[model samples]
Target chain A: MKNTFNILATIILVLSLSATVCAEGWDVPASVKKKQNPYELTKRNISSGKKIFQTTCKSCHGDPGKGNMLPLQPPPTDLGSQNFLVQTDGEIFHKIRTGKGAMPTFEKTLSDESKWMVIAYLRSLDKMKREAVVTKAVVNPEVTDVKIDIDVDSEHKKLIAELTGLKKDGKRVGLEGIELSFLVKRAFGQLDISGEEAYTNEKGQLIVQFPTDLPGDREGQANLLVKITDEDNYGPIEEKRVVSIAVPTNPKNILSERAMWGTRANAPIWIIATYVLGVIGIWGVIFLILFQLFQLSKMRVKSK
Target chain B: MTQKTSDKSRRNFLKSFGVTVGAAGVVSSFSLLGAAKAAAKEPEEMVNLLTADGQLVQVDKNQLRPTVTEPLNELQKRGREGIAGKSFVMVIDLSKCRNARKCMDACQNHHQLRADQHHINVLQMQDSEHTAPYFMPKPCQHCDNPPCTKVCPVDATFKRQDGIVLIDNERCIGCRFCIAACPYSARIFQWTEPKDSEKYKDLTYNIEANVPQKKGTVSKCLFSADRLREDKLPSCVSSCPNGVYYFGDRNEDAVTNGTTGVTVRFSKLIEENAGYTLMKELGTKPRVYYLPPKDRAFKFNGDLLNEENLH
Candidate 1:
């Protein structure tokens, strides 16, 4: 009886504590939510994980985050970039595993199968060492003219875009609506377009294309933009490139407070009216007294 | 459009009323009774026009035209009519904006934008100096959680049934409060007389018809109710040389730029990462999306400085 009472009391206490925790928000610590990097997975791992990207993560980030890159348009994330590469890979993986920010948390909905697959795909996006490029190539119908030279030693390779244009006032002026694609055909059809690349120039040349997760060949017909000039004057196609893709990643939280959102906060009309009326009332009384005194002085002067 | 509130013409209050605009108190008075004229003399309380239900409406007596401003009651009714039936939206492809004020000019011409009261302003913007520069043509975001409407003491600036936000300039008391409260910097205050062109100035004032710009009031890109009534894209959406603005009805759940007829579902587009509101953080939830400034068709240069990209 003594043993039974002790066990029953302990079970009741544990259950009550659990109930209290549930009533609260089930808060996640910032540190736990913060991304963990060293545990990042690799591309070979994520190739199998594409199914998870397709199902749970595809809604907001799209399949591979390939947004329409038309001029006067919003440029979707180039997940294939170095800035994105250096980020805590596992942190991103965890973000996909359990969403945060604008992304709905998937801890509850996703099965273990789906979560692991997302982990594999995110591992695939980490900047891989660019494969060495060979100067020589042959005509291959399967290959597009886009030339890409990946670095041999570095998993993360840098593509410096050198735009040739007339020197305007001693500065290299990047022309508008300029499209430059460099394609390098590698051995054994191992097509590598700048090793999943993204680029930005010192002189406002943002024409490089980023690979998104639609089923486009990684080897042949690589169409990466090098330079685009005054395409905004033309039409959408003139200055834009739309590559079909669908890679579901963690939400980028792009919809946060924009510049204009800051400008709209201020006072309403009733407060302003009250303030104006107060000023006017004071002035009105003052003006009335001054006018009466002036009239009295004028009459006295006339009598004198 | 829940049963399209076909302006249930109100029975003329006090039969008829005339309004004029001038500093003069007594101008061309045609009083039916001497007693009525005497009693009306110096009624200080008559300056601010109050509605039958105790809402304040500024009636510029001389400027009054024979048009009904959608009352607060009607606007509230429309708000109850959610996006379930139909909602029109515009998505601006930012990669295409050339800072060409084409949309601005179109808006001005359509709304008769006074020189001092520009409804649309194209701003040169960038996320950071490191990021590429781009031209962002700003119109009213027509926020999903509009702060302007929230702060309006009289509920003057109300969001409409068709997902457009407009002000009853007739009720706008020139407090300029709405001007401060708008996050988009979308509102424009008329400081002086509109100095409208001889032809445009003669047009009478109407709530739906944003014309005959009055002095000391606020205005902004209205999505041109006049045009929407005719089933046409807003001027800024259509006039752009670049197919940047995609306008469509949310009820239909599809958007189109006249030239690039790529129709996509609105919510789907938002989820697919092609669409987003302007300022999601402030929770204004603008209904426009931007395609980032990548390999833009128009380089961010002076060439795109036209009137078409305002939407």
Candidate 2:
């Protein structure tokens, strides 16, 4: 029985070992593969997608085409390679939406637009498309001069920002598809209140609801920061506004009290008190004994 | 003559008794061997299992065993470097803690700690005789004025610029000075070979997470320095089923709650919730904050209450 059991165990172990060596293919659904991306592969989409990729996909995938992907059982595909780029946009989209093996599903975390933007960014890494992207950049220089207009809607409790960019010809056009972030300035870092949705609409306007429950300084004042997230393309565009839209807070400082365990400057008074009182009490007793001895010596001299 | 006669009789009696006993033993051994053979012949129970290809098959239950852990991933080996210009802080809500011990479990798993050893402990707390009892999940406060760091004779334990306290086991002589210096009793020492010594023997020591733990070295809550590098929450912080933990950069002045994923102003959260540090009188200037158990999420069931939990 033991011999038979050993034989059976060995066979099963060998079978399991071999199963891991064989490559498994990703199953892309027919309906998903046929679906087309609605968004255009513009520079704006590519740039925004690049930013998303840096934050979300950079760690595992590494730099595209650099072959610096993390070492895993089934290695992450270098999106720059022809093997990955040959797949249909819909096929890539479905793969990203419904992840397999080590890759995580981004359907819930990212919107459809964000996924398309990532694809657009990934497609730009192609050798043929690279030259075209550069030529297009030179032909139409990016608008550097941009202005932000802040509007506070008190009745609606909304903070609004409008962005406009000036062309070389001096004509101002509302900048669309730009990502804007909202944060409340604190002592150390800015607290992001933009939540999930932060992109400006076609009119270059972004509106965020002012949280009523947010605790502010004594007079209920808070510094609100509205800034463009895509600084690489748009440059630095930030506007700071002081708004009274939070619950008033009077903070208490707990470091005021002196403690025994505190530093030399902030040491407890009890130790010093104990040392002084102890010295006086001990010396007083010694002096009293000496005085009695002196009186006894004086009595002896008088008797003599 | 009488003594010799008795001695001869005694030897003869012993020889006769031994012969009978040896025969009886041999008879019993044959029966015992037969019984063992019978037990082995009895059919082994088979467990039904589905293959990766979706085919169901029957296999002996003895074949089932947990697979060996995979090698360290890239993110785990990503060094103990602190994030520049960032100081991390944690705020624990006493009201939310229900003695679930999920945080403890996560911390232990991340650091490769034994079941008895804990990087974070959920302690039962009560102030006075009539006061309400609450659960307090205590981790290393990572004090700015840390006594533990000051007492490290070999400089094995040190504080980082990013407000994280880490231990280098490679440099540790295991004198246990930091363990004695810590007033909060946060540090623990490995008395014997660490849990899974053989499995993790090849793994390089991660200074930030303090894993593959070595024997005779002291380890405590690292505040998940490794996870912080990836802008992720600590194991204890993220694993809590209740919204008990809030972790963030002190430099950002914002802390995101583990369960709710709600980021709030550090000062405002403390002021509004009346958050206070543990052992304020000690002047350790702890980075960890605690919200008072004013309005609790769950009633004090005392499920984890025992002799050790008492004051």
Candidate 3:
């Protein structure tokens, strides 16, 4: 329990520190104002959309997709309704043909497996329907309740993380994807890891399996370090965490435990060195530039 | 110094104008300084997106294209996700729904939804392995307390004054944070550039009515707030066959399933009976309410589930 707390507390400290450093008030600096979407008003998008609407749905939904269901009394709900805008993509497509309640469906009415055109018409109507309107950054720290677990199929291995507890502050700068490095130590050299690569989800969980083609793994035998590299305020970044992976073997299929990694394969020293050098290189360049600029301004004032 | 920089880059134009910004690129330092004076402005090749956590990285103009479309409402304004007064919400009655794909198809057809990227999806859900299964079709809940809005760093997915949630793909950086934050898993990310129409082919991004969903962005149902503005049912509500979904203004105290109008106090309807919200523990305060399986139509059909449909 104490060890677990130590690990958990360390994780918390790292996270809070990250959050404090990247607070939005810290200001990410301003971004270039992007131009409006290119589709603001063009032919192919709007006209093609109209074409699809005209060809397929006009009969039921009505021209310009403003159709009614039963005869007159209850005007078919407007296709151009704001009420329709808030649904999930799956729900909308499912309802079109099967018919929800009063309305007759068009599963048979229109059949363009690719529904991109329909989505287009939906937007076009909104563009034409609503009143003319107008419109309107940051990165900070990453706090994590992060850990990794490995699951093994008789032939493969899975890596998982308790990343859900990881939190990114509201004002945080965005994170690049996670970078994980799998390694085993020198005392045992290298343990065979049938499949060595693992992938992390947005929540920070990871799972990986060695291809059956590669040798299956053995039980309880490797030291692993998962390195995660993400973007930092200063420059690009990379980080690391260590864990143990013990590949369990299958008695039924003895050879299923084909050898994968050589135990000595703990991440090479070069990777850490490279990471440190890269970070230093990036920070050094920025500092050097700032220093020179400071000196140049001083010289200008002196001359004056 | 700034002027010299522009003159060096814009030496070609200096002949015509006494002091000028050269136009090799649109956003050079000198040109930026003399921006007001120059009409022949170059298009800035890049823009920066500030992540929710406060990271600023420059993104090229080419990177922010079609996926960035206008929103149907003001859901993407700064500091506006879960912005009170912009309280969009929805209620899905599970007892009313069946395996009927009507709502899904209608949504697809109406939205001109692209394949592989469902604006809404039907979930064959069971809270636990022992629990009975039900057809749970998902649309953007337009939550009153939307987790999607809460986690959105740029306020790309936001609530509107009239209780609607919408996306402004233009302002969206496509980080998919909203997708992760949504417990209902109501949101979907565009893995590839949407096979959008030509109209969006030339327009630059603006925040209103997100369109031409770009690659690497999050999108979900917007509850057809535009339809509601015109006093019409949402495409899904109007399209469902079994009257499975009911939509209405809680303030007006009326709800309808496209064909039938069932008027009752919104609060009373939820309280008088066993209406429930999915994943209630998550505190999303979804707009959609479920009537439970007390008296459902059609036997619970587990056989209709194709494993492929589980996702």
Best by lDDT: 2
B184-292, model 3: which lDDT tens digit per residue? 7778877765666565666444233345556677767767654654556778877776656766555333355563444333455677767887777877667777777
How would you encode candidate 3's per-residue C-alpha lDDT over A82-178 as one tens digit per residue?
6764443344555553564455555544443324446555655664443322210122246454444444343344544322234555332222234
Off by over 4 Å in 3: A1-304, B1-89, B199-209, B305-311
- Report lDDT per candidate: 0.53, 0.77, 0.52
Give lDDT for model 2: 0.77
Tell me the lDDT of candidate 3: 0.52
Clashes of 2: 1
Docking class of 3: incorrect
For each prediction in turn, the share of the native Cα contacts (below 8 Å between chains A and B) that it retains comes to 0.00, 0.11, 0.00
**Which scores higher on TM-score, 1 or 3?**
1
DockQ per candidate, 2 decimals = 0.01, 0.05, 0.01
RMSD of 3: 34.6
**Candidate 1 runs further than 4 Å off:** A1-304, B1-84, B268-274, B301-311
The candidate with the higher lDDT, 1 or 2, is 2
Of the two candidates 1 and 3, the one with more favorable lDDT, higher being better, is: 1
Residue-level lDDT tens digits of model 1 in A1-304: 9999999999999999988965552244556556443323443234436655655455445645354222222233444455545545345555545554455666434544446556546545544532212112222222112222222211222234543343434444443222333232111111223232222243424333333331222231222333322233222221122222322223222223232212122234555568789999999999999999999999999999
